[model samples]
Target: MVRRFGNGTATARAREEALGKLPSPRGRLPVIGHLHLLGSFPHVSLRDLAAQHGRDGLMLLRLGAVPTLVVSSPAAAQAVLRTHDHVFASRPHSPVTDILFYGSTDVAFCPYGHHWRQVKKIATTHLLTARKVRSYRHAREHEVRLVVAKLRRDAVGGDAVNMSDLLNAFANDVICHAVSGKSFRKQGHNKLFRELVEANSSLIGGFNLEDHFPALVKLDIIKRMVCAKARRVHKMWDDLLDSLIDHHASKPASERGGEDCDFIDVLLSVQQEYNLTKDHIKAQLTIMFEAGTDTSFIVLEYAMVRLMQSPHLMAKLQAEVRNTVPKEKDTVTEDDLTGLAYLKAVIKETLRLHMPAPLLVPHLSMAGCDVNGYTIPSETRVIVNSWALARDPSGWESAEEFVPERFLEGGSAAAVDYRGNDFLYLPFGAGRRICPGINFAIVTVEIMLANLMYHFDWKLPPRSGAGRWH
Candidate 1:
């Protein structure tokens, strides 16, 4: 007994020594530690704090009971996301995820292990493959056409179109079609999905009280409060998902899971083979809906905002899109997107400046690992401040400016890409947990942006132009 106790004591001491080696700011309170230091915008605050106190772009903060590691530089990002990826591939299961994601079985929030690997495989192999996305080209093009038509119709009245709603609807419908082979808006599910996504975002997208004070949440009152809200949301999701899955499953085998099938059909077809539960299917579909619907719209909205602010860049992109597609064509097709370098560059630049998930879904270290010559103990919550890495002046020229040309030929970041290859600009993250829907999301944005440029000359309204795009 004495020997075992002595060994455990040595291990605990070593763990503390390892964590103590990393740079951390002072002012750790008795219970909350550094929670008070992080303000309204934790990402921005963390970025500034890291600049001041981080060593080799690594900063440690004791966020309540959790020990958090903030990664801010390219080298440090590579170390944590690539060299030690397997060790940090899992997620920290928060109360929100457990309640909403049906015990956290979805790809985005699922803990890494046999289940995650299998779920991700189903997503990549069956749902989000390049071929699968390509197969939906007609559906995507049709969605874009609807948007262009809506804008043109509104222009005749000289009334301003709500680009946010249009872009959001376009994104929502595209994902809905891909997931359930239905039009989300026409079927009256568009607003429902948006509401649920917003509700889920409020819970899952950031650090919550339960995340900081994990033990405190275990108390009956707090647990009931958190679980009640999430469960209410989950019940709505469950009802909708059941209807969609049932609609698809009732179809004949050949018609449902053959050459063309929605995500539900595919999931149902593979259910028996994969030994998946009904809850598992719903969880995967939910993340796909939430992540898919949100990413494309934000990129589209911000791209327009940035373009409206900079006329030159907008003109440059418009020229490329207009000149590349034949004059005979009324709308830009996916094929016309070929060799549209500036168009892709503009989208790439937008993602860099405004990734939907700035501090990407937190990665949990599964085992003790050495990063930047310091040991990160097992189960440490790791956050890669990707926003800082992408915007750091050290690695980017004119970093603060919205210059898409940097991604074109002969520019500084010309070699950089978002596909986990270059760590400097990780818009979609990297390594094992890199987003699998990149192709689906990018192509959807491209078709829409390309057509918007090809068909129209944008101008801010007389009243809304000044100081608005910024």
Candidate 2:
């Protein structure tokens, strides 16, 4: 019979006794709890511990001074991502996300509540809507032209190109143009933007021990890196936003109020509606750029890498693109995306294999909650390892393999959607906090990947062994 715990019941006592009897951590070093066990890859270490402890088991680790619970199974993921999504929706406060997100003013890292909702709604309806995203088609085409030009140069020179860097530049240009009506190549290009983008991406991969353990935040070396990066990024971000605000202020009322509304315009409108301060507006812009830019770039990079590693998949994807998209077109139109199911599958497959925010930003339990029979205490920092869940053998057939066809007909694979409902495959996360830019991201990746494949046949550069680049 199943057991229940509450109110000092026998089941509660038994559960406590069992927990007490569990072996003490092997050892703990001063100021760094179980850091040795984490080695270099903390995620791998957590997975090993979870496997030993059984699915849904909790392994307490002191990330610095913070207590963290790493949940590694699909069932546990469901518990955290679904059953108690509200409790886990709020992001943990950390120096890295705090500074980078303009003190958590942005939607991605903001704590769940009225403030987050306000920002999220504006982002969804005004900035990231399908129609708004489509308006940026010119930006996509312009960036792709630059990418093709570079690739052509590489092809003619027989030089090995770092496909990752190429894609990064492409993503940067597209995002810059979409948000600011400019390109990375625009006047006043500097290293600050690059550093800021790199720092944000690295931070997502879990570099700051302070994030997991707040007590030791001041002593964290990673926090120092974050602080330095934040200073540079915040300056660039402020300048950009201030320029937009000033531009709007100087423009004629009709030009400012009508179809000329850009991301900055939407933010200004929201600022007026909510009576937000200038700092708040600046903070929101910082969030949009930080969250939207690198994540899309990383996804695109991983998609290309996976496609390169899997030739059959690449060929199949190319055939689908060629069949659906006309050759004379410079780029695949958004309308063309609907007919490219295989292309969608490839993107989904890449997301499955490489979730940009693998853990989906740690969610804190605002209040006590019951999940899969476990009475999770209030204030427990809940983590959902979407990476493990996506790769779980039980949830997916040949989960680790790069097989886009598994998503096609007659396949035994489970349904994997970016929409927030499916806990097992939430690349953009699940619940009300789901990323608003999912549609934009999907279309951008699809169009970019389609154009690349349609225009050129990719090959490992000559004299550079497989996977090597100049």
lDDT of 2 by residue, 1-470 (tens): 12234555665565445333332255667777667777565555666766765435455555565556677766667677776676778877867667666778787878888888888888887889888888887767777777888888888977677888778767766666666565235554323455566766766565665665665556657556547765665666677667766765566756644453567666666678876777777777666666666777888887877777677888988898898788788767667878888888888888888877776678877765666555555455666677777877877888778888777656565365778766678788777677888887777788788878888776654453434210
> How well is each residue in 188-239 modelled by candidate 1, as lDDT tens digits?
8877888888788887765678998899786999888766778899899999
Report lDDT (Cα) of residue 156, candidate 2: 92
**Per-prediction TM-score, please?**
0.95, 0.87
Model 1 pairs whose backbones collide: none
Task: Provide the global lDDT of candidate 2 against the true structure.
Answer: 0.70
Prediction RMSDs, each to the true structure: 2.9, 4.5
- Superposition error at 394 for model 2 (Å): 1.3
lDDT measured at residue 438 in model 2 versus the true structure, 0 to 100: 88
